[model samples]
Target: MSFMIPSAIKISSQFDAGNIEVLDLTNPQDIQLSIRKDNQSDFFQWFHFRVQGAANQPLTLRVLNAGQAAYVDGWPDYRAVASYDRETWFRVDTAYEADTGELVIQHTPAQNSIYFAYFAPYTWEQHLDLIAQAQQSALCEVHDIGTTLDGYDLNLLKISKPTESEAPAKKQIWVTARQHPGETMAEWCAEGFIARLLDEDDALAQSILEQAEFYVVPNMNPDGSIRGHLRTNACGANLNREWETPTAERSPEVLAVRSLMQQTGVDLFLDLHGDEALPCNFIAGQEGAPHLPDTILAQEDRFKQDLAQINPDFQLERGYPPGKFGPETFTIAAFWVGREFNCPSMTLEMPFKDYDNRPDADFGWSPERSIKLGESMLYPIHQWLQADL
Candidate 1:
């Protein structure tokens, strides 16, 4: 009698933003794993990697530290994503066992090589392509701002009126995303923003460029991004928190960008991120910024109104509560910039889960929608700049 032998299963996370610490594995049903903390930091949540050699096997991978993750609420009713070809990602059955603090993933792989992620990954190669696409435009200028701790080039794009013009730009506008490397949607949205800005046919792009210079940093933490860390950089420093006193050794990414912002000076800014617990797209500002004049506050309101008119995805209704009145905490990028520049600044967040208001069963708050939201932002930006100029 001949007996069939199933091959040994192999798992790997040796690529960009990949994170998974396997605990125990026999058959698929009791595969145990834990999310690795970001470098030296205790923060953990994002996970992505590949599984192979076990096809057509029913698997139940359990996250051992589910309750200990940064956002435990993100697991309940949240489905994990899987891919066979890496081009198309679909949700797999997922549930959280609160009593055991386990996030269980149920899947039966159709192919030997299958991948899983907390969400669809937006990779570094794609980011380079985005930068290249922007550079194709004469209005776009690429800047190698600084070096990351891991030695990856920190890039920034500047788009505005041609330098041949006699007068300099009237305003300096800044937009940076992906300070938390796991918030991949932020860069996807930035891609849309870059595309819309470079489109020669877009009147809003042209108008906005005529009035202001844009400094767009698509990926703020390349080290954390490529390492798949949730919130910290190569040495475990949170870039957002380091804004107050960024050092070249620990947070060169922030130090470089902040230095440039100091040189150009910020008239307005937007810091983009993804929120695990929230299922909506919204904006948060530092109302606690010192002596925020009512005029600037009114501008914030008007800009939000314009945003609502422009993009159906954005809402001002649900967001982080205002910080109680106090001295500005420069630890937060938005608060630091709002206080320092006294400009209209905001922290824009997109949900990691499905947008509950307009849910998509097949694909949750997807990369495509995030990109579209980025494109739509041009309207409010153009309108706001027009009024000011």
Candidate 2:
């Protein structure tokens, strides 16, 4: 009988809530949002905002700058996540008015405080929890290869059978994410991969642990990821670019991960990522890597073709223009291990926007889809790793 109409909060494109100030909230039901462009840089894809005091009202928040945002194309069919406790994020109905360049979101808050993001964020705390949880698994081993400039551990998680045996038949598989810290969906994909690999009912998982060892670095840029940055490390260095020649001063994450990859010898490697421009899920390979062997190229193509058949969400329609090995297109996924190891390595890019071919505004290319992709990868990989294949 008594409903409380709490106040509202403004939104912005900036990360830290302090740098940009709020304008109005009195009209909570009809709120407006704006994006503040980075004056020193041309980046404006990141957004973080808060809504205060709207405890019980169904707030219809509108971001009028959606169409003008740096990657305006990413908003057409998307759902934004919101949380009453910042710990649990669920999607809300969001429609992008293409003609008006507006993003309209509707949500009714249960508490005075609320938080939202492009996806359910896997915060730094969650990363630490993942490390701790994996360490406790009998099939899991934790190795600290090196430390970042910030003194944080450059972590590596090795998962395999626990029995004592000299011949660990487990084929070596490696997965790393967050080379670009702002692409949080990468980590979500990693989460799904690790979860499926650890599932008890998963016979494929059981066989994988017995026949192959998995090395995962779920968060490669913890400092940048935690600092709410779109890309680059704490010192503003992009880790992906530093892979070919990683140094402690600039990029210890790549250094540690690459060192382990060489030691174990990567049979299969997947670098998870999110693309701002591309609206479809696809795989980018090292076909252009100078003198890439015929066998590895075949494996890469086979894997993509198989995944497309398994999941309708993934397609090979659009992706980065293929480039020959050179400084211009040097990426961790393209040139580093693929060239150095001469193995079947790839970069699996999910879209920040929904999978256009089969769009679901309620979910989009979301945490759920990321997880499914992780699961679907196992089948193709298993088939490829077969002795005959």
Candidate 3:
């Protein structure tokens, strides 16, 4: 009788935004793993980890608990992303076994050490780098609003052009993203928006700046982001749900941003996000809010139309049904902002799966496309301002 020996391939996930629990590493071909749940919450879907000593070797990794995740529908068409340098992430062959409830990732590593993630992670270091770079521009000012539950800085950027004769106060345009930490594409999009807003040579950006001031919070739940939680902060509180009545201990992140919005008064609001099940880019408007004005509805329609025309990657055909939030609508950021400010508030959702309208087999809905979408937002805002409503 002959017996096979288990190889010495190693796996780990102890770094930033890393979440994985190893089950069996006895065989590289059948390595077993499970995603760790968010702190104090049952939500678990995001996963990031590194594999070592498996270069040029075919391997199969299985997530045993994939069926029980918060969004099981996200698994059907999703492809896992991998990177050797952690800077350039590309999709690999991945499939979900409905019968076994396993998410299987198969790949042959070109390097001894390679990283994999649910999506391309936007790290805290990258966030810091983006803030530092943006602050160097004269049109931008960085502010440290408060500390998170984990003692991380909650940074906000205020961008506007200085003027001596202000005919009327520039409209206060508020943009926030990444309330769900796993939706890193939101921050990537925000970074692109900031970059173009500060660019001195971009005429569209300059025109928008002349009529509106931007208040942006790139990362809303830093604790959840750093802890690798999919939809909550340090205390397992979904920041979006706390907008109705945010507290200091449970959801200070929302309290701080909401308080600031109260002080500045929101004329227009946008909250960026990523939908796991959806396969296209779309906007969820605040039409469900009680007593929503027709003027605000008109503004929302025009903005969506402009965006669709600006980027074909964005479409208006498919999205959440109207009144999807139901009674819980006010708990969401967009609805709350719209109700409180009587302004045009929208939730812009990118996708974890490929954009079905303009699918890219190589890199489905990527950071590059998200950034371009962000840059394209200036046009609609300009159009809204030109309407002078």
Candidate 4:
């Protein structure tokens, strides 16, 4: 009698922002796994990996700790994204076992190798390419502030109207994103923002630049980003929590950016992020920061309303409830900058899920939409600052 050996099914996550702790792989029908917690922090939810040798084979991969993830609310109504060619990703069948805290993904790949991720991934190579493209514009000045824990460059970009004088009078507007690394939509949004700001024909962008000098940090945690970790640096420190007491050893990324912020005073600061559970794009203010000014609050309200008019993707209806922050000692970027510098600061959050107000079942919340949102923000930001004028 001749017996055929079952072909081996292979799973790999050994790339940028890749994470999945394999437990049992003997049975494709009952493959078991758990997500690895971010280094030095307790955040875990992001996952991206490739599965091979299982073309046309039915398989079920289970994450044992789905309920214990950083955002359990994200699992429900969330369909995992999968791609064969990497250029386009679509929703795949996923089920969450609430009682067991397990996320079960069932798929049959038509290709030899396919990627599955919580959301579409934004890789380090794409990030560098974005920077290189933006650098070609005469208005941009790229600066490698310092070295990250993993030895990657911490890039910061300054974009403003080209002036003949050594120094031009303009309000210093700071926009930084991707502090958590896993919130990759932040950088994509920044890409749209930078592209529009550097456009020669845009009258609104020109008007914004006339009054503002932009300091933009496209990625704050290259160490965490390149390592495929969800929310921590190489040493397991969350960059957002390090803003208040950043150290050279633990959080050089924050330390370096903060130093540069001090060198150039900030008039308005925008820190972008992504919320796993949310289905809309929204902004969080420094409501709990010390010395609360009525003007800043008014500006926040005005910007929120005005932005909704500009972009239908942005809504104030569904978002994080504010007033959860604290004093100047707080480590968050928006709150810290607001309290220390008396400047209006905000945290813009994009969703991993689709926008409930305007859903796209196929692509869900995507990089293209994120970039459009970023482009929409320039006009409102320019208009809001007019209150000061």
The residue-by-residue lDDT of candidate 3 on 230-263, one tens digit each, is 9999999989888999999999889999999999
Candidates 2 and 4 compared: the better one by TM-score is 4
| Candidate 1, 105-150: lDDT as tens digits | 9899989999999888888898898889889899899999999989
**Candidate 4 regions with alpha-carbon error over 4 angstroms:** 1-6, 164-168, 326-329
lDDT of 2: 0.74
Tens digit of lDDT per residue, candidate 4, span 253-279?
989988988999888999999988878
**Model 1 segments more than 4 A misplaced:** 1-6, 163-168, 324-328
What stretches of model 2 exceed 4 Å from their correct place?
1-42, 56-72, 85-111, 162-170, 324-326
Q: Comparing candidate 1 with candidate 3, which one achieves the higher lDDT?
A: 3
- Report the alpha-carbon TM-score of model 4 versus the true structure: 0.94
Clashing pairs in 4: 17-228, 39-236, 40-236
- lDDT of all predictions, in order shown? 0.87, 0.74, 0.93, 0.87
